[model samples]
Target chain A: MTTTSASNAGFAHGRALRPSSKVLPEHARGHNRSLVLQTLYRSGRRSRADIARETGLTRVTVSALVADLIADGLVVELGQREETRPGKPATLLDLDRSAFVIVGLDLSEHSTFSGALLDLDGTISARAEVALAGSTGEAAVEKVVALAQQLVDQATVPILGIGVGSPGVVDLGGVVLSAPNLGWNGMPLQSILNARFGVPVLVANDANAAVLAEHSFGGADSDAMLIKIGHGVGAGLLLGGTPLFGSRFAAGEIGHVVVGTDGGAVCACGKRGCLETWLSIPNLIERLEEEGDAARTAVLREAGERLGIALAPVVGALDLSEVILAGPTELLDGPLAAATVETLRNRTMAEFHGSVTLRMTTLGQDIVLRGAAVMVLSGQLGVS
Target chain B: MTTTSASNAGFAHGRALRPSSKVLPEHARGHNRSLVLQTLYRSGRRSRADIARETGLTRVTVSALVADLIADGLVVELGQREETRPGKPATLLDLDRSAFVIVGLDLSEHSTFSGALLDLDGTISARAEVALAGSTGEAAVEKVVALAQQLVDQATVPILGIGVGSPGVVDLGGVVLSAPNLGWNGMPLQSILNARFGVPVLVANDANAAVLAEHSFGGADSDAMLIKIGHGVGAGLLLGGTPLFGSRFAAGEIGHVVVGTDGGAVCACGKRGCLETWLSIPNLIERLEEEGDAARTAVLREAGERLGIALAPVVGALDLSEVILAGPTELLDGPLAAATVETLRNRTMAEFHGSVTLRMTTLGQDIVLRGAAVMVLSGQLGVS
Candidate 1:
């Protein structure tokens, strides 16, 4: 039931989902390798026969794939299984969870760039950060690289790869298509980091990365959207466990979508009543402070309602039942979450989408960092 | 290329796109079969070697699959390839487009249940309609069954299958979850039709069916949303050529989503300012009548803007570049389409989403019927 299991991996599903497409001999081989790794990753441990039976692969095929994985240092053989009535105790196989560490960077924070060294299971072992201090463009990029270097240096084991969660529309090739606050446009962040660290690098929108962390670790549904409300608002969409990379690689860029007809505040994108005006952290906090304690509930409710207005169509259009909110828990949990649920039920078909759930993310502030690790796991080792 | 080709088929992609899933020997056989068929379908005619080279299948494998297809009467050899070459001319192969006919029913029309007998290429060879002056419940159900029977009888060739495009939330099992206008609730339309006709039957939401037609025959982009505005407003989504069936099989049910913050007309769904209030044909015509000719342009523009407001988030969320409008091209093409484009550009990230195209569907009123045929093609023959 793990989200990152081969049954739910996002990297190859969306584009490669076409059944009419040919599955070459090489594709079958790669698919089988991933299948074996994911089976062990999901079950924690299994014998060759158990994996063969579960995946419908032959015993010989499983044994061969297992040997290859062990040679690559990706899997290790534990002691024989403890059984009372078996003819012979079979050897158990599992992922070498501690063999290598992954470097993850979160560059979407308002004033700092943060990085972490994480194990295969996404457990953070080390952390580092560098102050951004009003930096933009090249300066901000330098801060992110320095933080990643600091975390990479702290890794005690061989580094698997590096992953980054940045604020912008990132292309599939890991180019920062645009990030207004960080002053990047068409920056090849992944290539830059890969050259510097000489390891695989993967970069994605912060929200997109956060959704992966939620899927891999926080138990989010296969069909869900994670809305990350920070200095700016954006969403990450996972449909049937596949992240949607839109035609322009801007699939989850919903911050500038105008929400209400009765315009209120102008947005940075030059649109009035954009969802960011109502839901971004700074705007929500500013409105709450202006209204005082008596109207705190009202302000939060209004903001939540606006978010619901923006999300109701998405829910109906995607048939999504779960929406995870990654942001300040103190501001988004109670009144805001409740009002979003209420508004969604009122706007969408009750029998179909009435059960749509809105809740704060359990991953907290480390979600993007962990998700970055997942990207590296998926890209470098075919495991997430 | 042909949208229904194996390279773009949607049937198993979204659910079976997991690379970690095992591609059993049986799957490879089926995949290669589909590849050969889609290659010929896309090229109109191709030699076995041409298909082998294009699909990367061994020539022997393609020859074996071609033999099976010919035996099944799904393909026909059309003489040898015509060219001035030194070697022997290869035999040309193509789909047996007219060997079997599909019975397709469009039950979403306001006053009529339309049906058609279509070729494998989606060309209608015969048509029939049953007027529904004011039928609902059992009477409407009978009307649909009768219409399908009529079209099946009209087929000149052996019936390949039957497909129905009904107005409602249709489950994957083809049950009409709810279509209040026709008084259908939990009616197993597909099974009932199959029982009556002794042929495979597939049913989907009318808009969902129409979107398939747009993708298969109308040259729609892989990532597109077709908005069908008729008796009630709804949408059909295609991401990377795969139709999105949400968790509850209610994806693309956008009519009920509330749009403007300032409430206006109350909808049949008991919600004010739902997208239906602003976009549904009857509502728009009524509003236009109330405003008279002097304000027709203004009324349509406002409705278009409201529609844009409803769609901006969808475009941003899915990164859709093309939106095809069905139903009353006169109303949706000129002023409405222009305003929708303008609003979309204003509400979304300008640089990324500015090129999003809003256009009228070219398939006109027959879209759902054609889409129904496509459903049968994909379900019964692994083609579309």
Candidate 2:
């Protein structure tokens, strides 16, 4: 299928990319500083005058913020802009991409927890992993902390912060509400990591983190969902460049949502015909194995159709423009993805939602880790 | 059902109601003014110092903004406060609730196009309606204009603006993308009304308009959906106090989404087993009449289950806290609403989304009209 993965294209009509909000004077300085940094981060090297012009801030304000950023070592003076009909070549400034590394941990894997040292731009510089070995509760938490510490130690540059993408419903305060596999419920993971590492620690659902990675790094639309079909079927969502955290911080937790009227297999959540039962890796594998290669395409198509049934209301309700499937390419790319697109078209108002792009994500197994980096970048520096 | 319809409660966790955004100095004055107005609008009467304290704005800034508002006749000094503390009693200020009236038009009804003159508080001061009289195309457009003119004439106060809740896919630019029922395809409704009335005109889909009214006046959670099941079914969404207009301004166009795997009735949109076929007023009434009272509960329950099947993914995906049904309470309340709640609980992860409130709107038939007023208030004055 020809996928229309235009970056931030869905937000082009009504809302702007990061629309400015009304601010009090108390917040203006910090907001403007982030705006200047964001301008530089997104637009590459730009002079103080250019930053002021783009952000609608006065030159004086931009200069002061730039000076502070430079002093903080978060920004660096890049020689000068190439002269093009200017009175004088203005000195350029940009993010100091090499000055700091972020430690990111992905706790969504079934057998092992992975960690990475990622640069400011989400590039993985170093990697580490520790097998779960049937670890649960405090033991699993310890392994995560050890992995983060190892990644932190491997970083040649100063560590900016640590971001963890754990499985389950993670609240705004980074409390793991529930992660059955990890034997966690209401665990204060963010505070624990912050106390241990003494840096800004951000923890979110792995799917939530992955969506951010897709939003910030991958060429996904601003109004998009990144469905992560791994051990369990979950999704991450970004609406107008902001992550949506629902009432219970259970936003994007679509794994257990029953898909079709005709119920089938039972889910681990004790629900019959949950999307996870049809789409989760183990469930799909077992079903395919049971049916053999003769039913391979049929099995994949059926699973894909079920996913579409689960997603149709989401697409129709939210008017989401892009859906990026993050999982095994061999399973999600061809027949399954095609069937999903067909199902969506058949279900939604054709004229309005007919063109919703459904595609497999370019980021593979490291999506959650890289998304963890994005979480840190957004939390600490206010830039992603 | 015991409903948890706390006003704006869902937004209390992560995002604040109207969170401050980064702004340049040029935009700060207007933003602060809106903040002050919004504070008084939500909190009744308050002194300038109180507004400043509540908004984190400087006392001097608040004083200036309040003065400007008073000069504009949008706000009024409501005398001195009844002393509850030591020192001189501060002067209280508030929005002039009757200073200006808004003209609201609801073009969703099949037989009549209705209009109302509403006060700043969304109270309908006067109402008018023009029968369709078999009008379509240009004739229908003319009737809408006539009804608006009648309402505008009835307004004893200066008109703030004209807001229309039309039935169709209305874009951000106020153009009706397609309202097939009214033979409107890409009609420039807002512009036409603006050119005639010489006031700010805002047009939106009827359901979209209704949701805004619920969000602003009906004590709805900030993250909620208002399902309008009239001649056809549609939905209006508010996420964090902002209306969601999808990629094609059809974010809440859920009427046509095929609900179940087992197809049944064919819809006007040429879809099988669409949510509208099960949930629309015409469809429900027809089914109930055909099967008589014996099958009334069963038919309603089945329709409600289908509605839940359509909504479970949406609830799980967005983590929405409330779903308000806006239509005939006789048809939607009791069994249908209860079945929807039950289906939602059964389909979704019960622990996380068990409390998603499904309730009928108290606004009754005036919902779209009052919602139009909200559109006017939000568009012209930045407060809803």
Candidate 3:
């Protein structure tokens, strides 16, 4: 079912890989500088002229900013490159990897933590995971702190800040409003982590973090929706390269959107006819166990169709170019995926008829961890 | 629910007025200057520092821009103001009413009309409208051309640009992909109007125009969803003070979102369970007429609840602070509006709780036309 060839390539071609420079506000010069640093980090070492050309900033501005960055020890000049066609060779610049490291943590229902040692350019130098079975909030906190300490101890770089992506609604102040998966509510996550680690800690919704990660690194450019059809059918929206938190930070709760709206299976969120009731892996497994493979296949197909219909309005309203599926390959790569693509094609406005694509995550299970890392980087850098 | 107070004083309180400076892209300094000029035109005379403070630009930048504007004969110094302090009174600036005019056209299913006059800040100095019934595309074009000529002939000011807002999927190039209501498909509206009007012409979706108007002039001050609950449930999204046009031009088709999957009223778009099928005025009227007034009231209430639920995901996703309802107030003001508010409050996450407010359109019938004018200004001045 890997039908992504020229169509995906063309879609990629049509999209601008870098955020448009025209949209950057002048007052956000610092933000633009961070963006340039991020781009360099993502693309490895590049010359000052190359960075300026890529960022759409004047060479003079880039030079000044680079000089400041070097003076601040955030970035370093990597000597001069070999002359290609000119007399003088240009000096290369790179993020000072040893200057600072960001710690990323992901907390879920079953898993207590996953930590990554991210460098100045958001590169993960090391990673570790820990289990948290039957752990209370305090215990979980302690465990996470210990795990972070271990990760930091392993890292040869200086720690800058920490970012935590947990399954729940997180406020701007890093308070977890509710994490039903973890049976948490009103948890002062940032305060606890900050007190323990003696550093700034940022907490964000896992789905939002994942969306940011996908937008920043996963290559789903343009306004894209990342549907995580795993234990639940949560969605992450990247609207114009930004995660939409909505009025309540509940914007990506596509799982609760009633697909059937009548007598449908009840969802864990105490809702009926939720998309997740039919889309989740356990639900699919239960249905398959009860009704055999054929029925299960049929149900999955229908699930895909319903999901497509459910998302039709969002697509129509947002004119998104891509919908990235991140979950079990067995589900997303089969008839369910095909049905989703078919429904999207048929239901969307004719103008976007063949333009939108449904693609699977290339990062697979690592997406959550990477997304959590991205959350930390973005938070520390003030990108989001 | 007439709840006006000193807090609701127009333009004085930040919340009661659109933040004029928030949407201006940093690069569009000239556009920002023009916006200030337009604001002064609409609001009559305003002091220089007031304009700067209102526009969120640095006072120095505003002064420089205003100075240039005055030199260009686009603005005039309108006498000095009495200082609250014992210092010299500051000189006030106002839009030169005789400088330039803009033409705003509204093309709906029932009407093809033109509005012309000076938009001194956005205030209409003189206005005219023309009706086009039983007119073919060519005939409509000719009529519009004649109407524009008539307006120009009667005008005492130079014209800047012409803006037309129609119910269709319009591309940036002004090509109308389809207007099922107006029987327009793939029409090169911009080129046609440009050829006839001899001025820059902008063609955009009516909903997009409405959002632009709300963002520029209406009381919208934050991330908002302007739902045009007229004949259809079209929506315009304002994210971070910018109109969010999705990948294709199909964003804001909230009408097509399925509210029910099993069985519901059939929509004009050849779909079932569409939000429009239940919430639109015509749909409500039909249901009310068929089901009696009591049943209609109940239905309207239920419809509002459904709309709230339908928008819950969006509200949760974008964390929008306001939902602006634009259409007939008679239908939306009572139980329907209450239901919408209730659903949004109950369905959204707790943090978003008490954060969103649903309000009626302030512009009434002139909304679409004003929106069209805004669309033109935004396009002509390159302000997204």
Candidate 4:
């Protein structure tokens, strides 16, 4: 195995350059400690009292946890607050940005491998990508490992853990049950990566990871659905700021739901009338190619309408505030976006009226990778 | 208002008869307290130490909470375990079954009104049914209230709260957004009941409630989907032991999902090709009535097949453990059930390979009522 000098530097810097603090045990104490850290990380600078009030933890407990965090160099006390609230000024606490680095990996059919080095606050410090010669599981894994190593080598902070987002069903144990595009099944991805990198690894479905990224970085308030209209159609549901993973981890598999049960084109998954059969990038591209410019645009617009109809139940049930679209702008923008809005407005309860907003992802192609980094942060910090 | 002495007696007796030396809170507390109570309720009698270990709460905190509970006569300390495992004999604790009673009400078009009175542990102690005279919103609500009052009066325990499950989109505040059968739209149910009866009221979509009831009472060990096939086709999703409410509180509106884009019957909701349009009881009956006995059976079987096709994506994505059919047994049992199983097996991933079981609801006609009762229990005890 090649020695990852950058990984060592990141770890050393994370530990030495910042502060030497013992990691808390993952019990009740750890839960509170992580909550404090997360609050500071999310809110930028929150006083110990503010965290205590927000989290419902006692002020004494927050003080103790904050003291421990400060002693460990994971948090820093920034003197006193500038704003006054009719009382003594409170001491604002902020996360030590250089305390840890999270490595994120995104594996998609279009993009073989993309990796990012994120800090404690989820700011990407470094990134790298590798093209795959062939779109196969083995080839993809190999490229991912290499790209991960390169990204790790470039990191200047201490490495905390790694998170990977791949398509298909990912179990709690980080096993990839299946990825149709990669031709993978029952892949022991977590074990392999943990053994290789000597770090904790979390493997999540790409859509779920994307939602996490959006929830944390995109500033979604409460409930939202991140629809990924790429090679396939899938959704990541964020209900009350937490990603919802259904019993079989298929909560958001809207792609396979039959949109046109009879006489629709057969999907790659061998199903007729599947939403993905009509909405997937390849399928849409084929239709566009066959239908010409005006027809293609019309078809894309119609695809969005069908997608809206499909998602009406989701919106109605969850009472979400937004639907974040993550895909190529050429497909998701313009008429497609307008049609989606129209259908959603028509199908949903009028009380929701204009509550749900449909917007394109700001992170662009880097969304999956950023989401993976967010996943790592969430895992390490115990946010979810 | 006519005073219902029997209902008052039920509530008074249920609360006053509880053992005074119990160690669980009388009513729901904050998140942590509720988590502990839920753990005990689900797992059964366990020591405070064991509960702390299972729930990741501090022993001291658990002890304090338990003390508060015991004082309130909600939880009781059982005699010490006869067999000790190389440690101190732990005193087991359990929920006081007589502390509170939950009333569940189910109102559907075909089924006018049904209900059950459930104890703290979710054991149904009393049940009642009343015919619905009209399908309008006000008429249905009046019938439901009368039936609920009847069940409440017959109850031999103190009532804590009431839960109502109807076929519609319900909000957190117990308002029904729309129910085509009942002709309800934006009905303020919670406020209406709260005004009449000084107790908490929970309103949920029938399918959502069914999923919860199935998870807790239907012997479902993993994530499962409970499809309620009565006058309409609705689905309830239990994901990770919790009901998976989508973004808009309309997560399980599988009925409105278009199964056929063209040449399908128009739904009462003004949509075409809805699953309910093709597979609902009225539709099935109409097809059977027109086609004769042979075609009727064939249509039922075909309906099951179509359902399987519609549900294939959910199975593939969620890796669902089972699909429970609840409704008229005459339609869902035998050939229809068999056809559903066959289609599901064929369409899903081979590796899942007979993993998803197709079963019928054991509760029969009371499934919806019991589900509604479960919803009340969940809300009263803060489990959902």
For every prediction, compared with the true complex, DockQ reads: 0.69, 0.47, 0.29, 0.25
State the weakest 10-residue window (summed lDDT) of model 2 chain A. Answer: A1-10
Candidate 1 local lDDT, residue B330 = 84
Q: List the residue pairs that clash in candidate 2.
A: none
C-alpha displacement of A309 in model 4, angstroms?
Answer: 6.3
What would the per-residue lDDT of candidate 3 be over residues B30-115, giving only the tens digit for each residue? 44555575567557679888877676667887888888877767679989988789988999887676576677766653565656
**Model 4 chain A: ten consecutive residues of lowest lDDT:** A11-20
Q: List the residue pairs that clash in candidate 1.
A: A17-B13, A20-B6
lDDT of 2 at A76: 94
Interface DockQ of candidate 1: 0.69
Query: Which structure among the candidates has the greatest DockQ?
Result: 1
Instruction: Supply the TM-score of chain A against the true chain A for every candidate structure.
Output: 0.95, 0.92, 0.84, 0.84
Number of the candidate with higher lDDT, 1 or 4: 1
Task: Report the C-alpha lDDT of model 1 over A143-251, residue by residue, as the tens digit.
Answer: 8788988887788888888889999899887899999888999998888887787777888889999999999999999789999999999999998778888999998
TM-score of each candidate?
Answer: 0.96, 0.93, 0.82, 0.80
**Candidate 1 chain B least-lDDT 10 residues:** B1-10
Which model is ahead, 1 or 2, in terms of TM-score? 1
Q: For candidate 3, what is the TM-score?
A: 0.82
